[model samples]
Target: MVLTNVEEQMSLRLAVEDFLFEESALLDDGRFREWLDLVTEDVRYVIPVQTTRERAHGSAGSTTMAHWDDDYIGLEMRILRLDTEYAWAEDPPSRLRHFVSNVRVRPGSEPDEYEVRSNVMVSRGRGDSRATDLLTAERQDVLRRTDQGFRLARRTVVLDHVVIATHNLAFFF
Candidate 1:
């Protein structure tokens, strides 16, 4: 049966939501390598520095200082480092959970691309540590539709907090 434009768009949106959910699951499961495959070769993942100021100042973030700004190669290096025994940050490995919600998807300039925005909350706890850190943010992502499915082309994370409350960020957001 032929689908109308609206129906098709809705289907695409739903598909993107499923893709995002799967990605979240992978992260929570500590499947870093597998999660990397869901991104494009030229993927840009960045988290800009958030600041607090008067309303007249405009936006709350500045790209000049990024918490994380990485391309495919950089991301790969980070993933590789996680495997090293000396990677103290993740030596014991922190238990993490990624909660993604409020997903919104729309068409992009490219026919096979989409612009997606979502809210994210990451909770983490290290070995023998009673304290848990919660980091919350809003992510703007560009997803490209490929033969296999949707792959992340770019991601910009804008944290809600002006000052990061987490002890260390050793895992991907």
Candidate 2:
């Protein structure tokens, strides 16, 4: 069984859409554990800070002014924080909606992997919270096709808002 370039492209394109939708739903549903399963053990999820310098170009450095640069462990800790006795940030829990679209799959330089990019828009609301529309940035994800399925190895999130005005991020992107 094999596929031509067109078929592969179509399949991967749909897969990316499905993946984004599924992940978004998972986060909205508060299925953190399940979301964790979607990522590889060596996953990297970063939300790099974008300065107010421009309308598009954000900070590239992960350490520059990033509000978050999380690995698996860090992600897990976030979940734990939410479950804490007094996690003020999420005491009432914020409702989030992740809108992902315009996924473009670039030609894979590696035979077993793909370099994918997409645009994300997240809107969140909570009691007494200003209903922050977060730095909906672009993401560059490196997805690897495995025997099981497509697994995320790396994800770099370049936020549109370099300076986050909201509370701490306890949610998964």
TM-score of each: 0.94, 0.84
lDDT of candidates 1 onward, in order: 0.89, 0.77
Worst lDDT 10-window in candidate 2: 53-62
Per-residue lDDT tens digits of candidate 2, residues 1-173?
23468987798789877877887898998888788888888888887765555536653444665667788898888877778777787778788888898898865666877788999887888778556656477889988778877778889887766567666666666
lDDT of 1 by residue, 72-113 (tens): 999999999988987898878889988999988877878888
> Which residue runs of candidate 1 sit more than 4 Å off their true CA positions?
1-4
